[model samples]
Target: MRLFVGGLPPDITKRDVEGRFAPFGAVAGCDIVPSKGLGASPGECRGFAYVDFEPKDNASLARCLSL
Candidate 1:
């Protein structure tokens, strides 16, 4: 499953975000979308991210809904 996370701190890192969701399930991948605009670097956090979880017998869905 892919989760769209928003309202994150600007300084948060991709590893930081991945660690957060690690407890829920196996993280297939994580990517923090960089802010895009004048003065924004390519590596800047956009305050949003995409977290991909490896499906495990619907466990991911259950855990997420329980949150």
Candidate 2:
């Protein structure tokens, strides 16, 4: 199941996000995206992610938390 997540802390990583929703069920994967930038890269966080939860309940909860 796929879940969209937003509003995250700068130090937050894919694993961190993955763990947060893990309580719901098994986690297939979590994709944490970075923001657009140039040299030095700005290193800005996209503040969002796509999490794949194995169980339907987890996915549903993740979706709810995303919004």
Candidate 3:
């Protein structure tokens, strides 16, 4: 299941997100969405991130993550 993360630090980086989520499970991918006026390129995290994992177990692992 896809989940939404919120309440992250503005300066949060992909590496930082990976590190924080590593304990969760094998992250399929990490994306830091930039704001609209931010520009054509993706900017730093706007206080949230999306972490993709393996299976249902991964979803359970994600449950461990929160603000």
Candidate 4:
């Protein structure tokens, strides 16, 4: 299952997000939206991200959390 995480800090990294959600379950994948501009680079979070959980039940648990 996939979860949409918003209101993230601009400096947030994929690793940071993974760590935060890891306790709930195994994270299948994570993707942070990058800023758009001439010099915009990857790793720069755009205040939101998409997190994928290995098991659908894990996602449900994550949703129950206050994160």
In candidate 3, what are the lDDT values of residues 1-67, reduced to their tens digit?
3446788876778888878776767777778766555353467567777777767566567567552
RMSD of each: 1.7, 3.8, 3.7, 2.8
| lDDT, candidate 4, 6-35, per-residue tens | 999989989999999888778888999988
Pairs of colliding residues, candidate 2? none
Assess each prediction's global lDDT (C-alpha) against the native: 0.85, 0.74, 0.69, 0.84
Give the worst 10-residue stretch by lDDT in candidate 1. 56-65
- Candidate 1 has which clashing residue pairs, if any? none
The per-residue C-alpha lDDT of model 3 at residue 10 equals 66
TM-score per candidate: 0.83, 0.69, 0.66, 0.76
Worst 10-residue lDDT window, candidate 2? 36-45
What lDDT, from 0 to 1, does candidate 1 have? 0.85
Which residue runs does candidate 1 get wrong by more than 4 Å?
A: none
The residue ranges of model 4 lying beyond 4 angstroms of the native Cα positions read 38-42, 59-67
Residue-level error in angstroms, candidate 4, position 63: 7.0
